[model samples]
Target: MAPGGNRGWLLRLVIAFSFAQGAVSMARPAVSYRALALGADERAIGVIAGVYALLPLFAAVPLGRRTDHGRCAPLLPVGVVLISGGCAMSGIANSLWGMAVWSGVMGLGHLCFVIGAQSLVARQSAPHEQDRNFGHFTIGASLGQLVGPIAAGALIGGRDMAGTSAFALLVAGAGGAVALTSLWHIESRTTSKSREEQGERVPVRRILRARGVPAGIFISLAVLSATDILTAYLPVVGEHRGIAPSVIGLLLSLRAAASIACRLVLTPLLRLLGRTLLLTVTCLLAALLCAGIAL
Candidate 1:
């Protein structure tokens, strides 16, 4: 396919990613709150939340290895299946262990979808176009991040905690299914074979040891940890501050919008500050923001 021919597919991929990410974002806090409703203490809630990240940490490299050598599209559908089941199951699970298990499933599904989607983007775009294409791709993630929590906050509370929690999970399941619409024509068979031939199966250690890799990983981890903490803890902060749900939603959306704007102007930002300086500045600012939130 011509470069231009792939644009439509990329657009569809972005749309699907947005919805899938939105669902996961929505479900996460709902899961936490629901677990609390089921008599879980703060420690149990933390453990359940941590489980989402823990299992995926073990699975990501292997999944990446598989995608490097095989088809990316297969992971998309498989991820959807896992995400949908995990979200729905977590809602109905009576025990904390069951919720933790399903949360891990959801996290694994997220990792699979992201790895496949990113690999697809890398495979389809020319080297010169990679920066712009990736920027566009991540806009989908920002949109989901912007919208998901608001939807969750709106839907997830009521006089009946169990009932509201179940509803949130159902919505998440429906959101996961939306990804299926984009599966058609997402990956061409020819491209898959070519990717398998061209991509190297780098060991996790080597990938980590490569120049700039460690720094990039650390930066990504810090940024993500900041975002995760904000999402998971903000509502609790809001409660303490007596901020209404609507206000909290607006605040989160504002933060996401700022991130999207930053991404939109990333090229200019890089031109002004260079990569290392830009990363440093952003990380520093994010750290301050996180600290402010804590206070």
Candidate 2:
């Protein structure tokens, strides 16, 4: 850790990310509900949800490419703007098409922010410290995931479907704004030249073929997909089971908190089992948990 590197940035990043992520999480369900209220069928809701992911899919790699060569801090503010605007606009939009557009914007914003933020982390941390730092960084996301829906559930309701939905979106926008606080001092001029040279266009295929790259990518993809499906579909399960939204939120938060706890103690765990064994064991446990959820 460098000077002022006593995990202070990590903490600030997590806190900022929590608020930003919380807003998005809160807004997502609200969007789904609001869409339903506006007469969107399950298929329509699915389409809208898919749109959020779809729009971002094309942008992720390019954004990553850019961040590799440029300042990560710029993307933070830009992402905040997009997220806030998207959430707020989605609320106000009277038509499904309008909602879809804004949702795409929100997704794009998220992609930008994530690319930038991840790049920042990679740039900032020492090699030996990367794993712990990255683990700590994601805790912010987990925290946001835990809090966002609860906030949404609290703010949205009362049969005034449109009204409540609008409120939720507006609130999400405000939450996006909260991420701005972390934007301060995010970029460092010192590392600019080194990063630019390193980020220079390299063959994507070459990078992918590098040692550990394939495995790492696969693991990340699998884990993220599992988590995504879990988050998206869990509420539907709850709805069918007649669980309250607040209860569902709490349950999800419990899971997230547990994950945070895991990360907090990741160093000890890693030391105990080492990386390969640790990943295998935890991922296997996660598989079992997913199965349990499905059951």
Candidate 3:
């Protein structure tokens, strides 16, 4: 089927993605809170947070290569399983070390899901439709990010810090599993990877030097790093200041809501300012705002 023919699969994909991402999002802060309850010092908490990024670092290329050669649909389930297992296991873990390990597994699962999702988007979409499809996909992610923190905030926090946070993690696991329901038959059978894609690997350096590639990568990395830092440390900051978990969650959700608003307005904004200036202005504003938050 042509990419423009039916968009129902896209909606389903977004819903499933939201659930998976929400599970991860909720687990992030809950992990931090639970770590604190497990007698973690600042350094230990830092290590655990860093683990999420580091664990997925080396696995990207391999997973991408696999998707290039095989099917993308299978990776979605693998991701859901890993995410669910990580969240549930982390809840039961008694030590920072165990939490770190599970956190890595969780990160890997997320990487798998993203790789699969992106691959599916490329395979199933015509070039003209690619931009809109990607935008829609990002909205799904934003929805999860926006809701997850609020849910975490509501479920965590109380006299029994460890117990409450663990409960939240368990809940996240169940939420992740819910995504499985929407995963059935999302990928088009005819959209399998082309023989050309299955052949030789593109030279990474050549691709990186292509027009707009480096800048796009930089922007994506910058934005992602900022959000990851927020998810990892915001709750810790709240804990230190004696802030309520629900309040912290609200703050995080607002950030996510702003992200969604930006995505919605992006097309018109791009037409007005053009891509370069739009990116420049937005990045500057983000830098200033994030710095203010840090202070």
Candidate 4:
């Protein structure tokens, strides 16, 4: 079947992704709070947050290779299991190091889910529909981001910061589990078979040398680093500024809502400014915003 022929699977995929992303979003702030309550300072908190990305960094390529040669559907459940386990474990962990370890697990799980889902989209979508499909796919992430913080804010606040944050992590785990219900037959069997039959994988160096590839990678890395830092450190800022957890959550949700709005208007922006100018303008604006935040 052509990628755009039937979008029902895409809708289902979006729903599943929403829950998974939501769980991660909720857990991020809760982790920070829990760490703070456990006597971790800013530097220690930064290390824990960094661990959330570090452990997954090396695993991404291997997972992608595996998905290229095997089934994508299996990875989704595995990812969910890891995410759920990690969140729950993080909640119960007593020390900063233990929290870091579980945070790494959660990051690894997120990486797995993303790799599998992106591969699934590529394998199943027609070349012509790739852009549109990916846009739709990311809407799931935006939806999760929008809702997760609000939920976390509602649940996580009070004198017993540790206790409330732990409860929030547990709830996040439960939310991650909800994605399991939407994973029935998500991948196309025929496409999976065809991908397995393909020849040896492309080399990383060659891929990097391809036109626009390196630039895209760098751009993605920059945006992701900025976003991750903001997500992980925003709570710390709130704590220092005497902001309530509920208010912090709302602020985070507002950031997410803005992201969603940007995605929604992406096509129009592209039409108006074209890709190059749009990219330049957005990057410049983002850099300025970051600087303003720093100030």
Candidate 5:
């Protein structure tokens, strides 16, 4: 079959991705609450949360490189397993260190799934259809992000914070497992067969030196750092302010919904301002938002 010839695979991929991302979304806040119930302070929470991204940061490039040379299908299931296990294990962990380790595992799993899924999309879509396919792909993530927190909030709360949070994590693991049902034949067999790959790998230095690469990386890093800090710190902030877990969850859901809204409007924004200006303006606004949040 020609790339993008059949739409069924795309639908399945989106469904699976939704479940996978939903699991991570639900687990993130649950992890924070569980850590707090186990006596974690703000600093401790920060460290543990930071560890979630640390493993992925170092592992993503290598994983991407491997995907470039091999089939992308295998990583998807491996990622799902790791994410589910990490969530369930983190629920049972009694100490901060153990939670941190499991959180890192979760992050690594997410990285794996993303790299594989993205590579799959790139390989399966025609050049002209790439933009639309990617847009559809991201909507799956948005759907997951939008729903996960609400579900988490609905489940986690009450005097037994630890118990409730642990329950939520277990549920998240189950939710991740749901993705496996959608994974049947998600990858195209044509691409999975080993063939002689064209060209040598691009040198890291040369790639980094390419025009706009640094700027794009820095922008992504900044936005990601802000988002991560917000997710990891919000529950602590809520505890300090006496806000309820449900309310925090609602706020997080609202934030995600706003992100979805932004994506919906992105085409118009790009048409009006073009990519460079739009990115610049958004980055500036993001910096201001982060500063305000800090205050």
Candidate 6:
């Protein structure tokens, strides 16, 4: 929608997303390491990590509904502020509860950023263009996931675990703020929103009843939860085994790199094996690898 249908906006959006997502990716492991240094048991660690997800579950629907009616740019800055504040505060928080509270705030900020970003993509693209644009947009997330853990590892895993981890978190806060640099003029004021949709919202029951919907949701949940579990707990596992944080970060980067590679080849793989077969094979492989990691 630029003067010549330029996609400069998409590139800037991707850059902003990379920084935002990088901060979160870095913060998650730093939080775990930081919690461990605070004398938190694995139980406490789980509680703190889980809180990062809990608030977002309750907040996303309302936030989405709100974004549906308003400009998406506002949420981006708000989200950045929350993410930055939460990361910085968590670094300084001495108490377990304080860390948990800040973690939840970061999670909510993440949800806000993602929903707003995705909605902007949807609203800006035509139906025929949505697939390509969305694909390009998700590449930002992959880039962040690939880089963030390495940076965190470089900063953490010192003899002063508490201090080093806190420093990493502070750095992540600064990284998140960098996203604000690209957010200017992100939403076009000329874009109108007063028009109504063509139809009423579909009933939840009907959506649930649709063939493949529940199954697809379950598959996505399984995949995403596995990644989250690794991000939050791998450092703990590394600690138990006396593994270096840098090594753990390398492992995570490897995981992310594989994910990006798979996405790059997804279309060709889909064509070669078809969806059901690809799903089964990928799930089986993932289960085996996960079991190996456990051992």
Best by TM-score: 5
> lDDT scores for all predictions?
0.79, 0.77, 0.87, 0.87, 0.88, 0.87
| Cα TM-score per model | 0.91, 0.85, 0.93, 0.94, 0.96, 0.94
- Report lDDT (Cα) of residue 55, candidate 3: 68
* Model 5 C-alpha RMSD to native: 1.4
Inter-residue clash pairs, candidate 5: none
Which numbered prediction scores highest in lDDT against the true structure?
Answer: 5
lDDT of 1 by residue, 1-295 (tens): 6543448878888998898888887787778767767887767877887888988899877788777775677888888778888898998898999999999999888888899888888777877888778888998889887887788778866567667877888788788889889776677632644553665656678877899998888888888777776766666666557765556666777788898888768889999999999888888988887898788
- lDDT for position 180 in model 4: 84
RMSD of candidate 4 to the truth, in angstroms, is 1.9
* Runs in model 1 lying further than 4 Å from the true structure: 2-4, 193-196
Q: How many pairs of residues collide in each model? A: 0, 0, 0, 0, 0, 0
Off by over 4 Å in 3: 188-190, 197-200
After aligning candidate 1 to the native by TM-score, how far in Å is the CA of 75 from where it should be?
A: 0.7
Error of 4 at 121 (Å): 1.7
**What are the clashing pairs of model 4?**
none
* Models, CA RMSD each: 2.1, 3.0, 1.9, 1.9, 1.4, 1.9
lDDT of 1: 0.79
